[model samples]
Target: MPETILQIPVAKIIPHTLEKHGHVRTDNYYWLNQRENPEVIDYLNRENDYYQQSTAHTKEFQKDLFEEMKARIKEDDESVPYFYNGYYYITRFEKGKDYPIHSRKKGSLEAKEEILFDCNEMAKGHTYFNLSGLSISEDNTMAAFGIDTVSRRQYTIQVKNLVSGEILAVKLENTTGGSTWASDNKTLFYSRKDEVTLRADKIYKHKIGTAADKDTLVYFEKDETFDVSVYKSKSKRYLIINSSSTLTTEYQTVLSATPDAKFKVFQKRTRGLEYSMSHFGDHFYIVTNKDKATNFKLMKTPEEATSKENWVDVIAHRDDVLLEDIDIFKDYLVVTERFNGLNHIRIMPWSGKGEYYLPFDSETYMAYTTTNLDFDTEILRYGYQSLATPASVIDFNMKTKEKNVLKEQEVLGGKFDKNNYKEERIWATAKDGTKVPISMVYRKENTKNGNNPLLLYAYGSYGVTMDCHFSSVRLSLLDRGFIYAIAHIRGGEDLGREWYENGKLLKKKNTFTDFIDCSQFVIDEKYTSTEHLYAEGGSAGGLLMGAIINMAPNLYKGVVAQVPFVDVVTTMLDETIPLTTGEYDEWGNPNVKKYYNYMLSYSPYDNVVAQAYPNLYISTGLHDSQVQYWEPAKWVAKLRILKTNNNQLYLDTNMDAGHGGASGRFEAIKEIAKEYSFLLDLEGIKK
Candidate 1:
């Protein structure tokens, strides 16, 4: 078959000059920003068509890849049931179903089952549906959950009478898709976002059998920088309203038993201070960065006195370790900590005796606490996984120190063997003599020092650490002699808080450089070269992908960016866009001249110049609330005009989804298949 050449999309140029900080930028593709304009819709559809036509040769291959990946998954599967509040909740999927069925059994796992909500049924007749925040009333006779028919993430709150199996007449719209139930069982507190900015600003209290208009506005956050949310304390003693900005946090509390009581602030917000609280028997445990504890520490305050002055150190600050989270029990305090690069769960008795760490064999692995709902029990349930190991749920007896494997994810088809793969943690040297960590995995037979096709990935923003976790989809690459690696660069909390602090704001360039440095380090060490290397990330990580490709165009043969945030300066300056205002702390406010110039230096859309570029595959969702779809559309339009190379550049815009491409479990697999095939086709790999 003769190859069919694709006609590149030429977006109509409408000059829009954005003047800020005594500077002016004339955007040629700015007309694409008119989302409601039919021209904009037509242009996006045309681009999608071009992408499909360009990759038409791989249509059959993509289907095969999707099927191969889907086969590894257990078709009829049920998660490990966790007991919570007099019920054992379990989520299961039937063989051909696209969504999970949420159900519960009373008292014991063998007891009669009661279905909460079958998502497969609820998701029917809708292109996108998401159900979240399923909060059961304290009496266990009612349930309140949030649902979204559109992909914009704005959900409507729905109530159901569990005993009667009837949905109530009450409905609340524009919610954040979460609700906290009070001890009264009939009262619920939910958070709603600003209609325009989508900033979660208002928390409301709703009583059963009342219209949403009558719901009381319990609290309203005046600060645009801070977002608010509500949740019940683990002890169920308090309903906590947490308001947090990028750098600071403030928490208000109301007795869960007294739903109508006024909430009181535990501690006033202080700039640069961040803290989160959990309640135990007589005190509140605070994980905070108070007193310049860069890596954070645990402190305790009497239940009666929660002011900052009353807080005393329970766990002292450590310079080398980052305290991630803590789980309190009747006799044990299990702290999830990060030292070096791997996660560690350290178990300590309340009596301060017999302190130990749960041992993990993998050099690079993740282990964290799961739903340990009952504080009176000695058993701790946690999830554990690594690059080579499948996810496993374990129940550990704190007293006897016996660990029982409750469930290890079954990679169906009987073809997977743990012994055939090898995983390792390696360090890549950065420019300033700092050692960045990288977690790598490959089939044991392909581990020899050779220039193999390697996919290096990282998300270096928002203090979000990318851990070494197993993925059944990744096995497809591994089996094809491709090494998968995760770069634990700065901006991520993988190493410690200091690691994140150094890669953000004025020092944000470290993130881009760290990734480039890792790329060069891996290639120098003979893992892969520029000819065989590939890179991938999504959302904020997509921002990482955009920046790195501009900084080092020759670093990889191809790059995959999903729902990328490419137009930084323009997006940040416009506060009307969703998620733009709250992220000023992550990517500095471009309104200020200094930050404007800094962001402009690396803004991918602005940095596209007349130069040779690598093969590129970019994707976005038309309804993405996080990064507006037009950002990627405008970027591709500009790249088509300036890029000097003819290397393949394909853009896929999923019209049926939002920030997340697809809602169905199997449907999402097909998106991954498209991405994997793009990489494999470039490398000339075939089954």
Candidate 2:
């Protein structure tokens, strides 16, 4: 390791006092929240300079790691073509390009290719670019797409005349980067975000050739806690506007053929009722938690009478099974469920035939229905993958019980082999006697020794399950004697909805303790010891990284937190921040005394103490809309002043990206290389 002495960047502190629930606290690094302040930019730049200087010796090694990982990825990769509308759409990448080219073939794959958008050409001259919500018109002559150049997720919607290959003149600003076209191709509906909070609170209708300012406001979600979006139902009959919060949802619908018709509420919002609608033959299939169905259930209501009272159970709630989602087709209704912490795809014939689950051989794997757009077809498209196996896109015949693998992710390196790797699922007992699951993978040659370095990762919030899936980049760690594990902690719906319920709001500490328990279990089982264990997570999972280190800093040797939401109380209290208001149900509204007290107790920034801590690598994006850059910036600034140990602490801020980091495919690989290099360097692995 290089012993070059470097000056650490110390942010200027101007103490700011905040009082909430009659409690006062002083924050010295609060000024870092000033996104537009010159001093804030100076501090971030200095921090970046320090990072560059501190890791200067690893530059060549980082490059090697980047190339090694890049080699594993097939440069000219393409996604499985799914038949939708009148065309078969495909997204493919050229051999050396950083972006994808969207193209389509009419009627069949053998037809002449019609280039929709070559993103490589579109992304030119921009540091960051994202093309989202590509909605094709009913007539198949036009396409509406959203473009975000600044990376804050505020997209600009524009239309393209596919027939003439020319971008239309009108542009819609401040949208959520998606639009839904009415049956009349000339009319489109989209969701717009609030300029300050970045909340999708308004739905608007626009005519193709008109100015964006003249677009009519179809609906405005007055409740600050709710966000709205517009989309066309799969049946292509209705245009639906969905308004949702963390715990509640309401939808409005109108016939797509009548573009100017007013939308009628399908169901009124209730505080604890969460539901989603899918249009079918004569009714709308709903996946909901109404009537206290904690794990959710499948229900349906006639299209003419759309309300809670008219809803009838299609599939009753089961205590042990979580109804995650459903896909409707002309002859079969496919349901995606989670049972015993594994994905199960259930197929039921609409003609009253018996239903059965698709067989899966892996003990821990991710399987879900992919794109099944053609309703008349008997074949159902789905995806399957595990820690050791590459992802395979499969087409299953719902009637014949036959399946065909269309494409499998190719690991380009010659050294790769699925047979050489091992995957396992283990259980850990939490502090509350609750059992948590951990999915792990490593090279078969690796032994369960305390000396082996293990990287434990998780994201335990938003009822989002972190499934065990394949990753070519992960082979680098496994081959280097690293055991990669994901802790299915309480905040996720890994086990069921109850798992998520127990880890959120006032019970949020369960998430932190669940992770700590998993860490201890791995060590106790000789998978890895404290000195050889490390942690990693991003976004809400980044919050997990922050909390775990604060709660059990001595359990691991180091931690990597990407775009961490460390300043919990401060962020939750400020409604102007993106995602704050909508997440009140997840993290209790801190305005109340009880919630404020509980949040302050475990808030990472508030709980930073004068004690020894683990070596840390933190990352953030300057334009991150989900978790503002200031949260991590303020955290690092505070940690520097109060931490009692001289451990390695580094912060890398992506100057030209947002929460997901670099927009280019290869550029994203470079970020991963940097992270892996940090881990390998700590273990004294040079190559």
Candidate 3:
């Protein structure tokens, strides 16, 4: 079939000039930010039409790819049931259902199943639906849940009578999609979002039967750089309100038993101090970066004296190991630590008895504690997975050292074998003599001759580590002779706290450079070449995609930037945006001249020039709250006018979705199928 010739979308330029710190920038497509304007909507619709017409030839192939990927999943699946609060909670899906069925059984698995929420039925009438923050009262008779139908993440809180299966009359609007219930059952605390900025700034107390307008504002966060949230402690004794920025945190707490009691400050906020607290018997366990503990440490203080002055070190700081988190049990204290870019769980008893680490065989795999809600249990449930292996939920007895595998993800279709694939961890040398790790997997039959198609992915921001884990959808590429790899570069807490510190603020260029170096290293090692290499990332990682293409346009054959935050300087300057003010510590505050100059030097939208760029497939959601839809739309507009070569640049916008495309299980697979079809079509592959 002959390809359809489609007209490229041309956005109208309204010339908006922004100035700060004695500098000026003129934006031509800035008018696209007017989302409600008819012309802006028309432009987006036209781009969607162009994308559909351009890829029309792959319609059948995309379907086939979608089916091929979806067939590997078990349509009827249930999560491992975890016992908590006298019930075994389970989330399962029917064979043809699009959403999960949240259910539970009292006492044992053989007991009668009680359905709490059938999301499939709840999502029937809405184009987009999300149910979050399902919190049950201590008596287990009532439940509070948050619902969002617009996909903007401003959820409405509602209560439900589990015994009668009836929704309550009260509705709380503009909430953060979660609530914490006090022991009284009638009182709940939730964070409210600013209607304009969508920042959770106020914590409110709402009674079960009262109107939302009548709810009491318990606490309001005055600092624009911080957001507030409320939650109950693991011990269920205290209701804690936390206000935090990227580098600092302050907490206030009150007894959960007394819903009307005033909350007292646990610790006053310091400029750079960060700490998180957990309650046990008589003291509060705190993980903090006090006294210049870069990687953080564990401390404890009496319940009455919650100030920093009363805190004494329980577990001292280690220079090489990052203390990620700690979980308390009746007799054992579990510590999640990261060493050499790998996760380790250290089990220590309260009596200072024998302490040891869990044994893991894989060189590149992800392991972490999962769903241990009961505080008196000796069984530690943890999850484990690698590039080739499926995810497994295991229960380990901390005393007897016995391990039982409760469930391992069943990959249907009977064509998968763990032994048929090879997984490895390789290091790449960066420009500053630093070694960066890369986790990759490929079919054993594929040889490294610099001719294989490789998709390299990374998300280097906010100290979020991208661990190596299994993916059934990725099998479509692996089975077709593609090598998939993850770049554990700077800007992530992969190696240690120092790794993230060096990749943000004035040193943010290290993230882009590290990725570029990893690409070159793979090419030098004959894993893949520039002609067949691809790059992918979303959100802040999408920012990485934009930066790399502007810096080294010749490194990738094609790049996929999903909901990318490309307009760094412009977005950072607008505090009204959802995450701008709160992320000042992550991406430096652009209002300052020093940060403004540094940010502008590498901001992707500002760096576009007349160059021969690689093929690009960009995607965005019209209702995305994190990275606004206009950023990608404006970027594509700018790239269209300046790029010297026409190498298949397509922009796909999901009008019905947000940051995450499609809410259904099968519907999400179709989006991935479209992305895979793009890559496969570029490789001249068709089923």
Candidate 4:
């Protein structure tokens, strides 16, 4: 495949006038750069004159621009096909379909037709389930799958009898997601959730074949905000029950499950470890800060805390960050930390004390926050990353203590010049003197200066890290003479807990400031100028992109917002929505004055006032169960009606799609086409 390289022109890239508008910190003003460029002043003066003369004509320009890009991509056959009918999927595309499971035609479900995994036949090829994830049993007699194409957000747990290839039991709709198969195939221990608050989940137990058909409510709480996470530890017999809930604004309740335990009264007023004799086990591991909620530590249970105590520091917490994940293997616990803007997976001693951080090859790692891991393989094989390096499958082995690459996605037939692309890791100081890291990837061959089209991306939310990996879609941009960069600022798990703490809650403005720092770096380093700059993000990232554009709309030529949560304050306060309760740990609960005011500070949707917006492309899916499509849809609609200046707000939505645009290869190809068409046209790439 031929890689796209940028052609830069150093001399005139950063017009002197551009450097004058430095970053100004204040919540009251967004898009602080409204000054006109002198060198591009003629271009700007004419653009402004046109905006004043015909306020409504530019909408037609949007159509013309998109068509132009579609034509250019047609000229260059290397671009991946982005379909519309269905978004892309994590497919079972291997070997010939003559085999049972593989035989199910690809895209069969696009028509809402039945797509089955020939359990009986496919299981024989060592391709059990012709799928992934946990199975019903080691014998492969029965199969359990997390079905998503059928539903959005909610996953239907289906158990099939491999011998008959029949679905024996199906839990049609469930908020209780992430189903795990218990040792006893007939008995499945799944976590059930009660959507009382958007902040947390309550769990239940389900029996597979019994008349007690309904999932039995087990460990539940009256608090509107509490999180319940369960694990079928390596012991294979004990189920580790972990629950965390914010008490007031800062305090919390952390509880663990014990086997066959009964609750007893305690004499000590507080700080005594609570336990039940027959329900929760004697051993318990929890994510707690007991000392500080912001920074967390993994703790073990005290055998007798009330008895003048045997309370010991099972895992003394780190002051730098919180424990993002906890995975257990043969008494060895794996704790993933968000530190130094990097996701480091650390192995722990049984006592949960000493930590040996595993060295990872990828610049960014999955916090292991979410994703199903293969317990038997001891291999960390699932997660997404796109940074200085190309996107790849990072498979780490626990047994051999080795790491290997599983796959690298690339354009099937295109020729790529990777050496022409160079990735630089640099830091830009925010107004608060907070140094933020930015990752840039561009074709080194195009040192012709600022002529290169640049794409700046970021998603600063929930303390999540923007990892380094590859993206075939990048080839669509890179192969077309464009450069790309990612902003690792505050509010993301990039540098760990301290990074997040600096940008979240009351300090949320740090996110916007850090993003601005990234854009400034691009100009200062002479990588690309305001003329060729474009910015993008989605969902939370959408909010980020939106904020950046508003903060400095004149600096960017085009903006992309995919299902952005710009309406943060409104959505967070609306209890009617989903996972709003489970989200408090990430975004502070806005109902209370402290967090309410915090959310209102930088909410892009609510803060939309009279301003010069950018040439914007807004995308959303009708079925996006996570961030409601209407949020972005309404934001675009209002921006169209509200912005006094003549700017493009191209609204796009897939009526049949969910958060994921479309499904399957064909549909995804169309989507890729649509996105690239719009982007290329905006950048003036010739067809």
Candidate 5:
């Protein structure tokens, strides 16, 4: 091909005006939203073809990059087996296989393995496939799993008999893809999403060897803003149904033995009151934000009387800590807490005796509880990793307080050394006088220099804290003298709930500004310069990337947005889209004038104007159910028309994937390789 083909696809303008809350706006590329239109498909394919042609020279570099990353990973790796009930379950991958093989050994890990599912075999004859929600029956004779072939998050559940080694004829369609088997093993409960909205609205009960059409509706959520799910409690005594929204939650439950029994309400849904439940002994433990516990507190109530009035404080709320999650065992209670932007696991005796936090030496390490299925076990299994460290599985004995390393991730076929890398946690002052934490890592040999290339990443939304975790793929950058930093800005619960609160809604711009400030901090500290810095994020984080570039287009040298939700105003206005209704609390109801104006202010597509823009790389999936592919498609088209710079802007649309790029392990790495090649090529680092 030519040195570089800059032929950009221009999507025909078909102006569609929308008036909401007395506000008038015109969208010329709105016609791209028609998924069934052949022209839309053609336009997207052309963009993909254009991207491929533009980067065709880097094909060899992309392949080498992929191989370099894949070589760091152990292809024939197996996850640490954990004992559950009477079996030791494990998932392993064959050396060249794209999918995992789930297997179990009866009684002990040394026993002969019984294969439960080979995803590679199951994934055959499909362009995209996802296997989730594997729930085995109480007796362990049968298993139920959810499979999605279309990448829309809609699943079809199937049951398999372990004894006969046959997938039974029992199939349930239009389900969330995993069934909760009652104590009887024959009774199952599963959730189903709406056909259009794709919201998990109704849950149904099914019996083994029965037709799906004859399944009985067990519970239905009438509110469009809430989605419901069903699962068996950890204690296996009760089948719990949970309905939740962005800011609130409600729970109901029935005995696992009685599938036909009516579910009694455990707690009524109170606006802004969000809580999760776990059953143990004779009580239901609740992690809730009740009584103005903004960081959340632990409360417990008798199993029979699960109302809010009966709740008694178990762990009082703390101002400095955020209770992220909990794992219960017969003898111990493991609490995953985030304090001072670090994850700490506190192991407490179920009898309320001595409690202590697991020790981690790194300043920016991530530690959390892993699978601990045995209720009577004294050992607690967890995971710990940092930017300079590979992920390690650990087992700590509660009684002795001694810990043993079970498995540390092996980075194969490379002269890798943890001491060769340096990681630091530094604070960057935000525009509002808030200190935003930035975790960064680079090669020890690489000194701080303004000319060094840097990639800054962040996902500051939904109160989801971005913990600094290790990535083998990141080695490709670090080995190339590139700095990788994570801007744990506002909208994430990294600091506290207030940190997230301050960064969302009317303050949503804080997320964007905080990221920009972090970039400036690194620049001021001589880590990198504006000319060598690149910003990246995905989904909502993609929104962040869009906003940052708009606010300061000259700040970044390049940018990548994956499955970005850039068209915020128009998307939030349409309630039919998946997750739009449930996210009103996160982004606010744009039907209100204030929110509408605020959203439109930063909506990427709406803000695209005639200006000098940064080199851009954008990607999306045609079958994406979360953020529709058209959002990025339209944004790129508008940018192509309006951008006043000769900088390259490319869009790669995955023809056979959804929200997540690709289903297979190796297939997903290709996307990463392509992205790395884009940035490396810009920095002239091609091998």
Candidate 6:
């Protein structure tokens, strides 16, 4: 056999890499002083100003294109008739509320003419946006809803009186997560986070009537240095809290409890891979992989949900796909699973049954659903389609076997045929002989034109897949003779575990190589010329852009790295930074010399050898608690210094914005427009 390669620990290699510092891959210390790269920094500063100005001057866009873009984001009504106590309610979009619609229910779905929360109205009566995680009091007199900014930063909790179309309360802000009320509706419980401690995500529960700080401290997570999210289970009496591992390859912990008490571990899965728990009558259904490392199974437990020892396996995944979505109600269990590259939704027939063989309906993209007793009334299982079928709001009648499209977004009204925009799935081989799949959409009229400009996008880290999703953004590009492509390379969940396993930690180079391969595939096939191509990725995808810029400079003409994690070694090594410690699992602990070396090798900052790079723009937000702006700010500075090519390198750190800039919808669209404008300038596209 060829020599078995024994990889040295990153701890061992980092000292050497640092020893060779300032040399830009040459391993020399002369490069330590960042000031030596002033010229490069200055050039990049100019590029940064370019993006900031273009975005600032968004009024330059053609009136027709601007108007057309605005017309595409329309939402249909899924009016639900909720009648409780002495109140009647109809929930519909509040028109004229700014860029995106804000919603509230005035009467039930059967109400004569829908009374919407007026968009022209301001303050509490008119919310920032639609109510997510809506919970009406069991009595229906009080409606508790949540409104979030486009980026989900300014999460505000609101309570409305059903009959008056009036706002009762706008309780909190700066809240990232949300919660709801108990059956009595007198008391409400929700979680809060203080970004002060970067390590552990501390959660707090606030009772609606009490002072904010006086909210009950129901649970103080033992692991303060990790991520945590809690949800109310189907029983309504119990809650499920999930805590992820911080510094190791540990499986997430699932805890159970009621609103007033501490949570107890329902299951302590070792190699969890992925898991979810749902409650029915006497048994609790949990999908886990305690039995197999990569596989999952649906198990039923009669013992108290919190007792891990009592949990036993009932059914597990026999194939590659796991039990993705499941619900336990009244007498039945509804589940969604994957099979043969497709998703299946099914309703199992048993007190507690599962092969996880399939799901109840494969056609709908169900984020979640609630069912009534006997599992007869499937309350809400919403979904939408991309490319062909625009978004639709559906209410499935489990008992009658009938489905109602509560709201189907109206697509282009006969101007552009539905069939005109088609999705093409293609696969191309990478430099490492790996096959990377790509999804694209383009106008049918120009199907024969391979020379059209292209916008290639990807987010190939953290097991994130460039999964198919409907987007008005893609439509905008495709309509403009621009082909939009998603590069589902390794490091994402596109093909499950194996895809990610091959591209992270010591093998991190695969992320960049895979992206480069995608660029080459499109170019070699003449789908688009390298000069006309553009790449964009955010956060971990930002790391992707940084790597691509260094590894394959000539591949693309322009690039947009938003909130990029480009300074790999520095960011991962610096535990003082907010998101650094939590990322050790995805990116090996940089303090370890082994990981240090591995990271430094691919770190765009450390590897910025004197060379030409594409026209690049790097962006970050001052308040991005996750990926701090300094990492990109520093990398772009270093890149400008080390780069030998005269191409432009832009740096934009939005002082007013957090990780996602601009809270308003119009501002958000302007941000997109600015990036597109920069790309057009770089590609010389006349618009």
lDDT of 2 by residue, 1-687 (tens): 887578999988899999987799999999898889999999999999998888887899989988998998999899999988889999999888999999999999999999999999999999998999999999999999999998999999999999999998999999998998998889999999999999999999999878988999999999999999999888999999999999999999999999898899999999999999999989999999988999999999998998999999999999999999999999999999998999999999998878899999987799989888788889999999999999999999998989999999999978998999889999999988998989999888888779899999999999999999999988889999999999999999999999999999999999999999999999999999999899999998988988988889999898999999889999999988988989899999999989999999999999988888898999999999999999999999989998899888898999889999999998998998888888888899889
Residue 29 Cα positional deviation in candidate 2, in Å, after optimal superposition? 0.7
TM-score of each: 0.99, 0.99, 0.99, 0.70, 0.99, 0.80
Predicted candidate 4 versus true structure: per-residue lDDT over 516-543, tens digit per residue: 7788778777778888888888788898
Instruction: List candidate 2 segments past 4 Å from native.
Output: 1-4
C-alpha lDDT values of all predictions: 0.92, 0.93, 0.94, 0.56, 0.92, 0.61
Clashing pairs in 2: none
lDDT for position 423 in model 6: 66
- What candidate 6 gets wrong by more than 4 Å, as runs, is 1-48, 52-59, 62-64, 75-96, 99-107, 112-175, 198-200, 246-262, 268-274, 303-309, 339-341, 351-380, 397-403, 412-414, 447-450
Q: Candidates sorted by lDDT, descending order?
A: 3, 2, 5, 1, 6, 4
* Model 6's TM-score against the true structure: 0.80
Q: Which segments of candidate 1 are over 4 A away from where they belong? A: 1-5, 447-450
lDDT of 4 at 40: 33
Tell how far residue 4 is off in model 5, in angstroms: 9.4
Better of 3 and 4 by TM-score: 3
lDDT of 3 by residue, 568-674 (tens): 99999998889789988998998898999999999989999999998999999999999999999999999999999979898899998899888889999999998
Candidate 5 lDDT over residue span 1-687, tens digit each: 556535678899999999988778999999999999999999999999888988999999999999999998899999999888899999999999999999999998889999999999999999888899999999999899999999999999999899998888877888888679999989989999999889999999999988889999999999999999999887889999999998999999999999899999899999999999999988889999999999999999998888898999999999999998899988888898888988888988878778888777788888888887788889989898999899999998989988899999999975899999999999999988989899999998887769889999999999988888999999999999899999999999999899899988999999999999999999999999988999999999999999988899998999999999999999999999988999999998998989999999999889998999999999999999999999999999999999999899999999889999899999999999999999999999977
lDDT of 3 at 63: 94
Q: What lDDT, from 0 to 1, does candidate 6 have?
A: 0.61
